[model samples]
Target: MSIKSASLTIVTPNLADTRKFYEEHFNARPVFDCGWYVVLRLTTPYQEPEICLMSPQEGMQAFTGGAFLNLLVEDADELHSELTEAGLTPMMPLEDHPWGDRGFGLLDPSGVIVYCYHPIAPSAGFEEYIIEQS
Candidate 1:
């Protein structure tokens, strides 16, 4: 089956702050916004994923500590520079990874990890971990 669109919903206590943080940092525009729920999207022609923010539900467990949003970009270094120039500090400095990624990470106001990355040549020993596609 072909997929039309996809979105990731993050339930947090700080919905407003999380929504505002995405708006400011990613140039996201609100497609829908209520007090409890907000959907934001980047201003792009291609079908990018939507980011949804919502209030925590009653009786639900606390936020998942290690959940992260990964955004693959064309130029991660440029985006890193832009983020830094916008007065935001990265949770992790941009660096090349053994798994063939050059990226950085940041935490939103609600402590959600956002990783911005782009693919690069894999490091030494990458071939050992490579999985052949079926």
Candidate 2:
């Protein structure tokens, strides 16, 4: 079956705060907004991932730890500067990785790690890990 679209729904204790955090940091605009949940559309057109913030209830469990999103951007350095200027502290400084990525990480208001990255030349021995696609 072909997939049409995909989205991630994050359960948090406070939906409004999480929604506001995404809006301010990622430039997400609300497509749907309710007291318990909010659906937002990322302003950048590079990737169309719908981010949904929902207040945890009965069966829903909030993600208290770990990485939740990996966003590939054109320029991680520029984005880092932008986020820093916006008063968000990156979990670590942007650095080149052995897997051919220059990126950094940050924790969102909900404690989810978001990795922002861009592909670059692979580090030494990284070519051995590459498998040719048919």
Candidate 3:
């Protein structure tokens, strides 16, 4: 089976704030919004839905913690600068990782850690983990 697309829906107590956070930082636009639920898609050339935010319904529970969304960008430093100037404080400061990228993290309103990064040369011992895509 082939997966055409996918999105992660997080139950959040702050649905509006979560929606606004993604819109401002990730160039996300809502494809659907119904007071308690919002689906957001990035305005990249591909324009695919990437995130969904929803209020906790009767049987649902708000996300407490432990979700990390990693986004690969063209330039991490540039985006980090822009986000910093926009008043976002990084939870994880921008730095090169021995695992092979430069990145930083921001906490969204719904308790998700959004990590933005760009590829960098892998540190010596980590090079073996890079797999070429066929």
Top-TM-score candidate index: 3
For model 1, the superposed segments whose C-alpha errors exceed 4 Å read 62-64, 132-134
lDDT of 3 by residue, 6-101 (tens): 889999999988999999989999988898988898777644658999999999889999999888888999999999999999999999999889
For residues 56-122, what per-residue lDDT tens digits would candidate 1 score against the true structure? 8788654666778898887899999999999999998999998889999999877878999998878
lDDT of each: 0.85, 0.84, 0.90
TM-score of 3: 0.94
Clash count, one per candidate: 0, 0, 0
List the candidates' TM-scores in order.
Answer: 0.87, 0.89, 0.94
Worst 10 residues of 1 by lDDT: 125-134
Pairs with backbone N, CA or C atoms under 3 Å apart (clashes), candidate 2: none
Ranking of all predicted structures according to lDDT, beginning with the best and ending with the worst: 3, 1, 2
Tens digits of per-residue lDDT for model 2, 1-134: 99988888888886777788888888899998877888898888666678888888799788777655888888999999999998889987899999888999988878888899998988778978878721
TM-score of 1: 0.87
- Regions of candidate 2 where Cα sits further than 4 Å from its true position: 132-134
